[model samples]
Target chain A: AQSVAQPEDQVNVAEGNPLTVKCTYSVSGNPYLFWYVQYPNRGLQFLLKYITGDNLVKGSYGFEAEFNKSQTSFHLKKPSALVSDSALYFCAVLSSSASKIIFGSGTRLSIRP
Target chain B: SQTIHQWPATLVQPVGSPLSLECTVEGTSNPNLYWYRQAAGRGLQLLFYSVGIGQISSEVPQNLSASRPQDRQFILSSKKLLLSDSGFYLCATRGDPGTRGYTFGSGTRLTVV
Candidate 1:
């Protein structure tokens, strides 16, 4: 079965420090990977996506993700962490064969000031 | 610009009560509509999706059912609510396969008592 996995349930980082949220995916054929952030009581906001081409994809809110086909991972990263960036992050992949997008079990990111 | 709207922002219903949540997309035509549920501390689970009017594909078998009577209107309904159904529900629309991420609405919080 096609699936996405966020190994960490929570990741903590101090403000101004670099942060990473790990994600791995299993799917048939090329994968369309995405990252989304959810604030308290709000719908998910798209962060970035890696469809094709460049391995490093940048998106809204100064977030970026590196897509590695060999490792089957698309990890979200930020150069510097911010208190406002603390939220639930989800990794997703468009499963073409299943005709749906599958999401990982999310990782809560906490940035301490 | 395309926008998706879902309402009501929050709902409290009694167990066994019928439920209706509506979602509509603006500034887009014949777009793919999707319904997703996010339980507390969990990832988004796709409920249903529609490519066109009257075309609904369910991702999971559950008490919830979805209908698309118009091109841009998607409705999620349940004949009877269950305590397990209380969660955050989100509506999303995808336009142009080239688009990287789906546009999500501001989500609805449903609480079953």
Candidate 2:
């Protein structure tokens, strides 16, 4: 079974500073990775995905994630985070043979001023 | 332009009550649909998925069930709701083969009273 691990339970960053949320995946063959954000009572919104080429994938709200095959990691990053960027973040992975996307334990991002 | 919608946005039910959460997709055909649940401040747990009409695959064995009666519609139901079933329910759709991440719906927040 394919699975994703978000080692960090929470990440605190200063506003206007760079931020990162770490993610690693375990799977057979190739893996498709994704990042999503969820607010208070809303559902998750898609941020980015890595299916094929370009190890560095860009996503919404000025977020980007790097897919490292050797490390089995797809870390989400942002050059500068806004106060409003603080939310719950999740890392997910999917296999070709799997119909459902497996999600991580989630990382709560807190942007401090 | 594919869009997904889920309702009602928030529901409060008593224990042992029945549930019928509806999800529908527009502007997409034969899309893969998924249902996921997230506890407060936790990651998502895949509940079920569908490849086509009347085709459902359950990821976890629980009190919940899902059905895809229409090509672009999916419903999550349960005969008797439990207190453990209170959470945020999300519906999503993937566009093509080899694609994993998805377009998500607005989610339904269910609180078992």
Give per-residue CA lDDT, model 2, range A1-113, as digits (tens).
89899999999999999999999999887898999898988878889999999999998999999999999999999999899999999998888777667889999999998
Docking class of 2: medium
The candidate that achieves the highest DockQ relative to the unseen native structure: 1
Model 1 TM-score (2 dp): 0.95
Compose the digit string of candidate 2's lDDT tens values, residues B6-65. Answer: 999999999999999999999889998999998875888889999999999998999999
List DockQ for all candidates: 0.67, 0.64
For candidate 1, give the docking quality class from DockQ. medium
**Per-candidate clash tally:** 0, 0
Where does candidate 1 clash, by residue pair?
A: none
Off-target runs (Cα >4 Å) in candidate 1 are A95-98
